[model samples]
Target: MLLGSMARRVLANAEGERRAPRFVFVIQSNGFDAVQACPESIPFQKYADREKFEQLDLTQHKLPKGLAALEPLKGKTTIVQGLSGRSTGGGHSTHGGCLGLYRTSPASRSAHNATIDYELGRAAPGILPWIGVGMSAGQGDALMHYTARAPHKSMPIILSPEKAYNAYFSVAAGGDREKDFHLKRNLLDYMIGDVKKTRRALGSLGGEELDAYLSAYDELAARQYRLLANKDTLGKSAPKLDDRFTSDVATKRL
Candidate 1:
């Protein structure tokens, strides 16, 4: 079990008030195209976020009936394609698809190391932001989650449906959106709390990466903190998430 999983199980016995969530996001990798093949998936043409397909004419880019099964999720997804993460990983075949998910830079040099997932998670490891799943095969070496520049510590991918289900259903140390405010507010507070100690430990100056990394972390914390305290974060305004926001019901040929 992941460390967070264990913590939640232990915390289950505690008595406390329930808290609303700050946000929720999902990632369905290579299997998404396969899932889209479901007759149910065709409705995804209706997805609202980042509607790159909004202008597409179904007749030209027809989806297969296999996608129809995924229709129920049409309004909730952000169907993205051709998003370049990086390039190089395992040549044209083996399984480089994972690397392309979000590397952003060229694959040759853009290390998927400690990707955003980890940065976000480590940013707040308590919540376990990255609920990982592997499709058709195992979780593989690449991290479904990542830091800004580095790939997460490599672990075998979760390649089975049963494994995915188990991970998804397992208990976890849940984070409360309301309670998160203090944590976010204090992130810098806590870090800066020891600024003198940190300075003393590091001596007169810090390196470029450390300085930049700290600034980035601070910016992230401040934004999240302010968003939470002020209730100013963006909503799930995508038309697919809520149809009323959409311009029209997209009618596709396939």
Candidate 2:
């Protein structure tokens, strides 16, 4: 939620006003001990009120041993504490509630509502609003929705590195990858044309429902155009494929 709010602020700035900030979020499912982040200089009693909010100057105190790696970025970093997750319903794992802040079951395949990351992704539009890559606890699970894009819709987390590489960086790979990209663009074009014909056939019968579908296809077609325009940049930044991408080890996929 904090990242989403910050992204909105940065995006709201007029051109040349301020540079956008890059944000990365890491999720660890293992249990977390509050003391691991609590500085040695601060007393535990200060965090007794879980609902309260407190901010401290990192310059005046040392970060806990676990978070020492953030020393270099202390100036831009903020550590928040005492935020309550009472509504998440305490358990071995909060499932979708970990991000949605509402009770959810691990067995469920859909989300109750949009997650913070989804809202952030939408606020800062892109060809692919968001991409999730993570290891799944279930054996041989190559994809999972530990997150959501909207209510009743779960965002996919690409668990296979090979699949992830192709999904994001394939346009730069040339050969089959580039061919696949063009094929998808062509498919979208066909779909848009078909939808237009259908809408026209419906005439006065068509309502916001048809308009919504048309608008979605239009946005997708626009993304393809943007991708083609930035092909050079994509080629320059695409990661080189290697053994790790196809490694049998689950952690290597990350």
- Report the C-alpha lDDT of model 2 over 93-147, residue by residue, as the tens digit: 6756777888866576467887887677777755556667877666453544457
**lDDT tens digits, residue span 1-254, model 1:** 43774566457636463333233333444334433542332454332444453443343343456544434554433344444433523233212234335324243433345444434554554333344443332334234222232442332345443333223321121345334445556766677546545656787575554555566556546544444433322222211223322223223201
Q: Which candidate wins on lDDT?
A: 2
Off by over 4 Å in 2: 1-19, 39-55, 60-69, 106-109, 137-143, 188-226, 250-254
Q: All models: lDDT?
A: 0.40, 0.73
- Candidates' TM-scores? 0.35, 0.70
Say which candidate scores most in TM-score. 2
Candidate 2 displacement at residue 169 in angstroms: 1.1
Q: Which pairs of residues have clashing backbones in candidate 2?
A: none
